[model samples]
Target: MSELSLKVLAAGSLRAVWQPLMTSFTLQSGIEVDTRFGPAGLLRESIEQGERPDLFASANIAHPQRLKALGLASRVEVFTRNRLCLTARKELLAAQPSWLALLGNRALKVGTSTPLADPSGDYTWQLFDTLERHHAGLGEYLQQSSLKLVGGPASQSVPNGELAAAWLIRGGQCDLFVGYASYARRLRLCKDLAVIDIPENYNIQADYAFAQCYEAANPLSDFLLSTAAQEILFREGFARNL
Candidate 1:
């Protein structure tokens, strides 16, 4: 590896966008990046366990903020935003009258990431809370019945290029999966599935944040917030930090 190269730990949801973003950054800045993408919370644990990457990009602000609080990182900033959505088997869609009905069906399975090990899971939990607030007992049922299928330390790894929600739902692992809306477009392409948006009132907004673990990553950090990078993120299913 080049001495000027930087190691970056980023959330798995960024995998699709990060490639193009980094390509542009390297072309302009002449700095190579070695990136590992996974559940943001697990990446944070790796950092806490002495695996030091020059930069950490998280799916949620909380994980990065926790690192900053632990004196392991600097200047947490929200770089992008995402929202939660549901991906369900096409057969399930035909059976249920609505996404809400599909979720409330006691026989159908729901898959979610593991909480505390992945920020996506945390957001899934938050979405459940919103559901409970609006329709008492519904959220609690989801929380109880949902399968923690991915994102935990011991969870099965999602094949590198496959969309987890679609993969799981197609394999009959779950009738429905709750995950980042960033995958909405690609998931929609799958013939076996349907992407359903969580209503704005019930959806949880995911704030993607990043922090520099080493001063050497400062330029990369600055580059991420630039107009070029922001545009790429927006094109790839993320929103500019508002």
Candidate 2:
């Protein structure tokens, strides 16, 4: 198989947890692994266009499900899980702010990935939907708040990495970054950032899935589903489907 070079398309949030293992995968297996990381939807679109990726790993389960149902990727495997959280600059955390506090703070700017292009953004919409069900004022709050302090507007590309939501806060551009707590867990480089574990009511479970693409010609696709690969994957923040 021409010495197996696996092209993996995954979420940018995975950079920290996946790099170490991918390095190990390369060294031990002598397989060249090339990765493209970004919002989940964008990556999937790339694969859909016949990008010839060997394996597709995503932060959300829905996209893989869609691909499986559409016959784009075969042998879908549920690999791991994750969830979202709110991140803000440590200086702004005051006596445990609530979602109400998050929406009401006029001085604070809130940013999220684009719902149409990023799953994280979609989760934020779901959170807002929950808020709207009870806090009808929240719908107005979002409209007003979006107009009041956005850096233009919320988008799929949040200036940088998916977790750059912290950057939005640290840079004095925003107050709260709606993002993944586990994804934001390891960015020691971001100073003075504090995280709030999203309440159960606001939480959305993320199940990561991997599928072997039909056009993928790499043997590493099979290897990635192997016990050895899964062990590395487990350490990289994914739980088994079962």
Candidate 3:
């Protein structure tokens, strides 16, 4: 039988989870997969611009739903869940970090993904909105204070598939980054980085969704939702969809 070749455009944050799964899938199915990793919104734009990949895996449900609305995808399915967290240099924070204090501190540089271009950014905005309910004007303050470091019109280019949040902190571009908890865990492996969990009340769940852009069925899509795949996602710090 001829080997099958498939194209997959996935969220950049899925690198840690997807790479191993893809390798296992190729070995078992004799499929050759070509993958592109980036901010979900940017990849969605590419698809709208006529780039057709076999599958689209987004960091949030909204992006895949947008594709479904545009007739680019037949359906959207929730694959995994994530939560927002704060990532910063260990030396930049006190012994016990508080989200409120960190965000309200004007002297510390805060970074977030570009809103509308990355679901992480969208979730961060949602978090800000939630914060507004607790403290008047705080939401606007955070929005204005945060540096849009990735996944936007003017985002800086990152090399070697490094995440924008990690790159920014490593280069001293920003003192802290608000991003996915899974990403924070990945970064926490670095000696100098600390991952702080957001309070439950302020945390926004990031629901990842995926769709097959083309009519053809891809086994990998089904595989992603299987028990084996969910296990990998869980091990990588993603919360499984119940």
Instruction: Report lDDT (CA) for all predictions.
Output: 0.91, 0.66, 0.85
For candidate 1, which ten residues in a row score worst on lDDT?
90-99
Q: List the residue pairs that clash in candidate 2.
A: 80-238, 80-239, 114-155, 114-156
Most accurate candidate by TM-score: 1
lDDT tens per residue, model 1, 1-242? 35579999999889999999999999998999999988888899999999988899999898888899999998788899999999988877776858899899999899999999998999999999989999999999999999999999899999877899977987889989999999898998999889999889888989999978888888899998999999999899889865
Q: Give TM-scores for every candidate, taking all chains together and pairing residue i with residue i.
A: 0.97, 0.79, 0.92
Candidate achieving higher TM-score, 2 or 3: 3
lDDT of 2 by residue, 183-222 (tens): 5545434677777677777577777777667454245555
Q: Judging by TM-score, tell me the better candidate of 1 and 3.
A: 1
Model 1 score (lDDT): 0.91
Instruction: Please provide, for model 3 over 1-242, each residue's C-alpha lDDT reduced to its tens digit, 9 standing for 90 to 100.
Output: 12388888998888788888788778877787888988899999999999998899999998889899999998689989999998888876764377677777788888999888888899999999998899888888988888888878677777775766778988988988998988766687788888888989889999999978764545877877888888888988898867
Decide which is better by TM-score, 1 or 2: 1
Supply candidate 3's per-residue lDDT for 213: 78
